[model samples]
Target: MKVTKTSSNITYDIEGLDAETLLSLYRNMLKPRLIEEKMLILLRQGKISKWFSGIGQEAISVGVTMAMQKDEYILPMHRNLGVFTTREVPLYRLFAQWQGKASGFTKGRDRSFHFGTQQYKIVGMISHLGPQLGVADGIALASKLKNKNQVTAVFTGEGGTSEGDFHEALNVASVWQLPVLFCVENNGYGLSTPTNEQYNCEHIADRGKGYGIESHIIDGNNITEVYIKVSALAESIRKNPRPILLEFKTFRMRGHEEASGTKYVPQELMDMWSAKDPLLNFQAFLKENDLLNDVDEVEIKEAIVHEINEHLEVAFAEENIIPDKTEELNDVFKPFDYQEIISENVFEEIRFVDAISESLKQSMEKHDDLVIMGQDVADYGGVFKITDGFLEQFGKDRVRNTPICESAIVEAAMGLSITGIKSVVEMQFADFVSSGFNPVVNYLAKTHYRWNQNADVVIRMPCGGGVAAGPFHSQTNEAWFTKTPGLKVVYPAFPYDAKGLLATAINDPNPVLFFEHKGLYRSIRQDVPKDYYTLHFGKASMLKNGEDITIISYGAAVHWALETLKNNPDISADIIDLRTLQPLDTETIYASVKKTGKAIILQEDSLFGGIASDISALIMEHCFKYLDAPVKRVASMETPIPFASQLEQQYLPKNEFEAELKALLAY
Candidate 1:
């Protein structure tokens, strides 16, 4: 593929431009380049730890940011130094991050390039290419929900287009028509490999057409062209809200990073790109347009040098970057306290679905920063209609609808959560959570532990079996995270518990996993709270007390156990509801098991490596002495949950309390 020459040039685009925008663009690009160059010097002098230079792509960064309005979000690539430099990141913080200072916004835990904050209207950068491509889509999705005309601009390298995330993000962006602009810095190489060897496609922009995303190409080195193209694209994006890819063809003036010298770059190729320097090209454009007077140009260069030096001085002096401490260690086995949470139900006779809905309503009413987003959650209430009338009641921003990108959806929720907003993520199907594991496990679950700051995001997963949801939809995967520390897990059986538990989960300082049973979506009926009521995470409800044996269950299983207990009057059996499983209510379990002198751990999940095992272990460790007979655990057999009712009942443990209770009584 060869470069396309357009009729319009810098002189044509700016018919009679004020010197301000042009000079500002030139000044921005020059500062970042000099910063990168100065940083490289620092790295060599042993004053800095790591450095990734963005010398080649200055034009795209400066142009795109210059065109973007204030308060609009910008998600940058590691190479877009100009964007972050212009956007609220103080030079000192950027320098401080590289120097390994704790004063860095992320407390210096995050790498230097992985910076800026959503609260600052500057979506943070992710170094791993293609991973953050979908981030802009999420911010745009939020803007659409808020009924706010905000355009989110995301930067990427030409090599990033090859990543699967790129395709997934762009497709979702186009399908939902999100107001996002994908800016690609096509610097002719994916690290060492050139574009010719990397991909056969003529342009990355062309790939967007297949997904129905409007796209364009521009001279990335020409800041004027970059600004004009982004301006036009951003306007169209906010209006129709469709995905558009803008390929900015440019070159990197320096090697990839401080340590990486261009061993592969040929002398001829280097000479050719030398004249195409974006900073120099912009300087010439400004000179030709009479925007660059000799005195003004000298002042711009001097000011930047002074600014960079000042940043270096403060950054090194700042006491940041805590050396890895042994004190940072936390036990995976330990449980968090549920004492801060207080809960009580007010209303009576409400549906289980309404319980969840009311909890969100009450929480949203109380907390102004709460954000709700997922597929079909905006105009429509949701798949189960649990969110029915939510959009109409709350308006779009707080209750949002999103394109079906599960990973991006959860990630954005994680981002919002870190910003002090209580964000509730709607996973249309609980099984879809596999798509979002990286951010959930790597970032959200570990954020607080990594730093002193907590991640208070709540992921609302509509889970469970009994709905003929085949292989992908019916599985119970909460066990995957039950073992994970720093996460509070909740599964409510009744409407009262549902409302109370949900409120508690949302308010917790740690990340919370809320698995709502699909079968109970419209099943059980009971009274819920009108005002906010929170249930403790570690508390276990003693559903029914019996002297014969103890039955421990939760979620849908709790309802089944209750039904079984009512019919069996001969055997005095006690029932325990394990409200929140992470910090399992061992006290309640220990007390009930000691009283009954027998215990049966029951659950819908498979018998192998499931929660039942955890409960059984808890009994053996604490309540084993209380057992009059051997402890028993009843769970579904190890097999894919079958669709047929009879097959499912046979494969799954069904009402085993009758036989189990009789056996225990005779013992």
Candidate 2:
């Protein structure tokens, strides 16, 4: 390849790139520029609700996208309209997305640039902006594992660099030597805050050096420089498989969105950047080089304007689809296959912790695409030693230890799931999920609903209190995830159920929050099957049968119900252990409540907004006529679990539950 040097001695390869490719780059930039202008007119006319202008920085998106191969993936930010246009997504589809039509990628569920599509190999960013970096790590990881030789280009703004995900994604990608290009388009301000207020570093690329990643700074106004540098870097990464952070020094000519005007930006600065606009500079370059003259420039822009007008007419004529009740409720989660396993006489008495280990081992043996990740999960066997021997058995590749980055790993799991890789993420302590809350609720839980993508990932949460682990470590936070629509919450009481439900959670087509009570890890034991077996979600296990009263609970509280029933032998009650909290097994609860005519819901989580509240309301709604008395609930006190044993004992729901159970029975 022949290299050409600029006056500043910056080199770019020009021989290998054809004239058609060069002209195509100009065309790509022109499409978004024209579309943005038309969309601004629409915004003023009330035809579209919002627009994130890529007016001045089209070179960055177009350059990076043209650099990447079609098979490779690109996770774009809000101002990356050039990426969508260059990728050849239909003009009508883009218009529909902007107009919030059902024909759009998210089916009118989300607005501009907030949706991802597998069809175009484009993963869109959530409003959080940072998690997509980690998601890019996962996509690159999948590509590396599959030997696809594909490099993922993930874009972020200067403000997003302040996010923890940027650090986490860079660190992991460098450590793993995955093929990822972290592109930062520093458009001077994040919303209204300037780069100076966002970070202390001089350049965003400086942070990547701290993560041990190779870093670069480019003249983003010059499309030739961006395309040449990014293309070379991407190709090198594809061959050598590593991460590089490139800071594209560009400017956003328009406001953050159409509604937010550029009043905060200085007039002189705006004029200075406008004079160096990427479209004008690139067009001038093409003309100077005799690649594109006045006629070519006018014809190219005219064609783009005509195309935009044609697409707008069609999009305006199309009717918007509003989802009805059934459509709205359905499609949040993909269907899970329920398989019942017959007893094979092979059984071993094992503790709950051992059953968990056995379940993971069996599942790993079954699924080749399955990966296990978390802090100290590889060699240290995790904090509780549940994976004590997994490193030796599964190898470092399968049983990988991650940095102490809860948010990034969770989003990475989401990224992996989109590529058909199933991941089991162990939150060392369930309380740490607070750090990953945004990714779980916003990204993982909502991705499927937005774009019909399956998040085939399971987050194993070691939750609940009884062993005096205090408030942070010991928390029955299943209710938090149960409230999220796309997530499945599973909490098993016995060793047999733990093993079986885990297998089912691993196989489920959506994200499952599998809660494992640390207190019950060693205390509970059962004759769990030696062979692989799967249980079904939305199904409750009938522990003991009675007709006097019904006890409803899950997790460690299910054991409490069992112990309470055992102590009060005179109280004949149907003990319903709800293995899955989200699905609720409402039918079983209703059946047992109708049969017994009395019910008491139990939980280890505090009373306010507990899963018990939902179950209680459900029983009252469905089993009202069959009840002998008003349904009662027994839950932990509305306070953080204490460190002292006595305070913890007082805070727990065991005694309270027993009392509530007896009172409901007597009524």
Candidate 3:
């Protein structure tokens, strides 16, 4: 393709030339520009809180979107107003979203561009810029695994290229050769941080070559050029899957938001770009080629203005659905039909680690779309050999070994889960989860509440301090995630509970943090059911019953409590093992505490801000009348786990639990 420039217009010599398509492109670009202008007016009038304008970059968004198939997925950023317009998103719905009305896509949960329509195959971006790129990579992986001819277009800014997720996503996409388009809107500045400050590279596309993927750069202001180039690229990707990074060099005319002025931008640079405005340039081209008459242009503009006005009126009349306080707890976990079973046949004996591996194998066999991904998980069988022989059992496609990028691991799972795939991710150690905490807490935990979407992903965490594994390798971090809504935290001590709970977590429709104590990996053994079985979350297992005192514990602490009970046979006490943390089995604990009239909560984490504190508070509020003594808690000291075996032994609360139980009984 070649471009010819005349005094009044520019023309392109493309194979499939049609006047109607060119007019539609101009019309699409104009619609978003007008809507953004209206939104700015609303922002000034205090009708809307803020506005992120896509004034001069419409050509890039509209051109790329028009090239994509309707069924293909598009994960858009804040400034991709042209994307929504090209996808035929109703103008009124966009207005209602900005107005924070209940009828909006997010049901008034999220304001601004943080909303997406599942029906349209669009996933909206959060305030964070880089994680969504990894999510789009997972979507493309899902499409490739399912043998679907679909492409996922992910948009990001020039500043986003600096994030670690950007590199991680690009590497994974290229390695897997998935059909994904990394559209970088290089507008020169990332919220006042110039390109020079962000990176030393000359162009963002230069980084793509290092990842072994093809890269291209184009003038973002030219509509016909972007449309033709992206269209051809999309077709090639669908035919033979692979990732391609495209850099659209454009400029943001307005500031980051309406409140922020353009004072930071140099006046000379602004003047230089203003002369090549995409809408004006495209209109001039249309007029010069005689493709659009003045009357046609006027009619199109009038139609768009009328439609936007009608939508605005309707949206303003609609009521905002303020969320009720009670509804906050709802939709955190999807409800499922569960039944308890008593097996008649002899159970198969297995170790804790083997049971976990077996459960993963069973889940993969049951669901073809279920995928297991982590660092060294495929051929090496994970860091702990928990996934041994998984690659041969389930091919490389289902069992993927990812790079040492924790954020991308979790975000990609979020992406796959949204596209009808169940993902199970393993953190090498629970302590290392801090790297991916942003996506885990902000994105995965809130997706269901914010967009009414399911994040069907399970993050396997091997936690707790024991066997002298220092601070980095061992830590009981369940309390950190239990406070987060939209996540289910499950910790099992017995092999039976570990296997059954893993199955339930894999099947649950919400994100789950499955904590497996590394100390119990080979040390514990039990008779697990050979057939498939699921253990219910938010339920406590009463190991032994006594009327004196109730000892509540989970994970490795449950075994310590059991051993304490065995040593002191005369001190009769009831033991309640909590299988799940987030959905605390308060009902069971309340009943046990009422029967015993005394309670002792045990944990292996630090004494401060542990799950035991939450349980102690619950006992005080619900079972205070029946309590014969204050609910005691036995937990590790408020310090990091030591590397030495003796110090590590003292660091845990195993020995303290027995003394606490004896004191509770004596009280």
Candidate 4:
């Protein structure tokens, strides 16, 4: 709620730092500006594909990054090139990155600020600028939990302040009182839209009061003011461990990217900002303080230009790693050693919910750093009561109850992964995932493939409908994520599969979507191990073996298939329960279909564009000659799940499953 605005015209009273540090800051600021100018030249020559020029806004990136400790983390935006330069990231690697060479951070998988490296403690922003805010919160949360005196500084533009992620991340960080410095570089324009079209608030920092966090605004063009204010604020946050929103009011001297012309910006405004440029203003400050003169500035600029040219030559000489098919295929997810779960043979009967709860409990005990976060998950023990007694047993630090910010929660999990901490996120209901889909699909799912960064998080989705919970709450939307690469989808049907697969998912080094059917939570009980065990993904469990036909299904539909067979004992089948939808068990499916010569795929999701369609195609492609009839698919109608009991029952496709099976057998 506290706000401070530095005046545009103010006398400098530099405090708490010596002349050497001041000169270093000037050098850091100059290097990036020079680098940007050089990169612009290369862009014109078609040497680099594109460049997001941060010409006018060097002070914000330089001051914030230089103010933070070397060991601390930073998530820089596209225009914050000074952050990387200030952090002393190797110039050769950066040049290689700009040139899309193999030596680049992402090995040409991505360019610009679309990559991140844990080695440099710099996790850059994806094209979606706002998600990195939540990621910053996660890293700060990890620091707090581990008692590490590290503060994370994350950058975003003024336009990104309007994203839902901005609010959600701030709210979560404030509620948790995390050690995070939220830096907003108000660079006048987001791409082409001016600040007038962005928000109605007096200033972007004004919105910080709504989240109960401290706020500040500064003349971002003044490097001295930026360094002094941000240094004090970052130190305060590091010591007290709370988020503070700092808005750096600056202007984008050039277009968003070189390709986009700045014709929309008024010449007078551009001229006004040009005179107040960060580099020029800082040079004047140095001269006035007797620290730097015209000759010293020339030497510094010449040295930086020489350094950049040498690195540029090396980067140009390095071959761009054109990934072969094998490398491209292997990079999607980190390779994990698959371990078979060895059971002690001691068994106990428990509900499906208990199985999940026990798996989480055991995993938390096994991995001291493991965290479980979701809405109402701590004291409320989740809406399904799956996490009952977890708060008392695991404590609040490990069993975190998050605000209703699914996007931030998922993003925080990604941050935790960056710090080598594993997390499990529970979506209150699978239907609510739409709100958090962007981070799940774009950030967490793509981190590994993009930069070799492992997103070690498990997102638990409570899905499906049998209790008539209406359209919004009941959804079997696994197909949405299954189609997304760099994600593993696990949906377990029985208590046994649920416990085993959940354990495996928590330990996996990739982002996993673990779907738990609400209908099967208490309705099914099975004898599972009292001790820990894991089940491998992409391996289907054959519940029943028969030669008549192959019945392939998963989640609640596996139960539905078993019940249908019980009612009609005349139908013989090889019932395959797919515990994991992605990294699909096509080998098992092909084996079943080839042996049976007739297969029927069952799903609770709508028929169109469902997992069944992909499976049917795979069957036809591999086992075509072995099939006696066309593959059959029985699915819920292509409509939103209904609320009425009769209509819902008809819409579920369970009743029609029997008829479909009989007809397929007759053929």
Better of 1 and 4 by TM-score: 4
Candidate with the larger lDDT of 3 and 4? 4
Best by lDDT: 4
RMSD of 3: 1.7
Off by over 4 Å in 3: 1-5, 8-15, 339-345
Checking candidate 2 for backbone clashes, the offending pairs are: none
Tens digit of per-residue lDDT, candidate 1, span 1-667: 1122332233325533456766777788898888888877877888877777787678888889988887888878778778888775788877766665777665666676665564556755555566566656666766776678878888888888887668878876786687888888888777788898877889888887799977888988777778777887788767777778888877766667656678778888877777777777667656655668778889888998999898788987887556565534452212346544454435667788888988888888877768887888877788988788878778776887877777766666654544456688888888888887766666566556534446667888888788777667877778978877667788888888888888878777677889899889788897665677777777888888788788898888887777777676676878898878887888888888888888887788888898889888878888777778878878877888878777767766765655765676688
What is the lDDT, from 0 to 100, of the residue 647 in candidate 2?
98
Q: What is the TM-score of each candidate against the true structure?
A: 0.79, 0.97, 0.97, 0.97
Model 2, residue 465: displacement in angstroms? 1.1
Model 4 segments beyond 4 Å from truth? 1-11
- lDDT tens digits, residue span 544-651, model 4: 999999999999999899999999888889999988998899989999898999999999999999999999999999999999999999999888999998889989
Task: Enumerate clash totals for all models, in the order shown.
Answer: 9, 0, 0, 0
What is the C-alpha local distance difference test score of candidate 4? 0.90
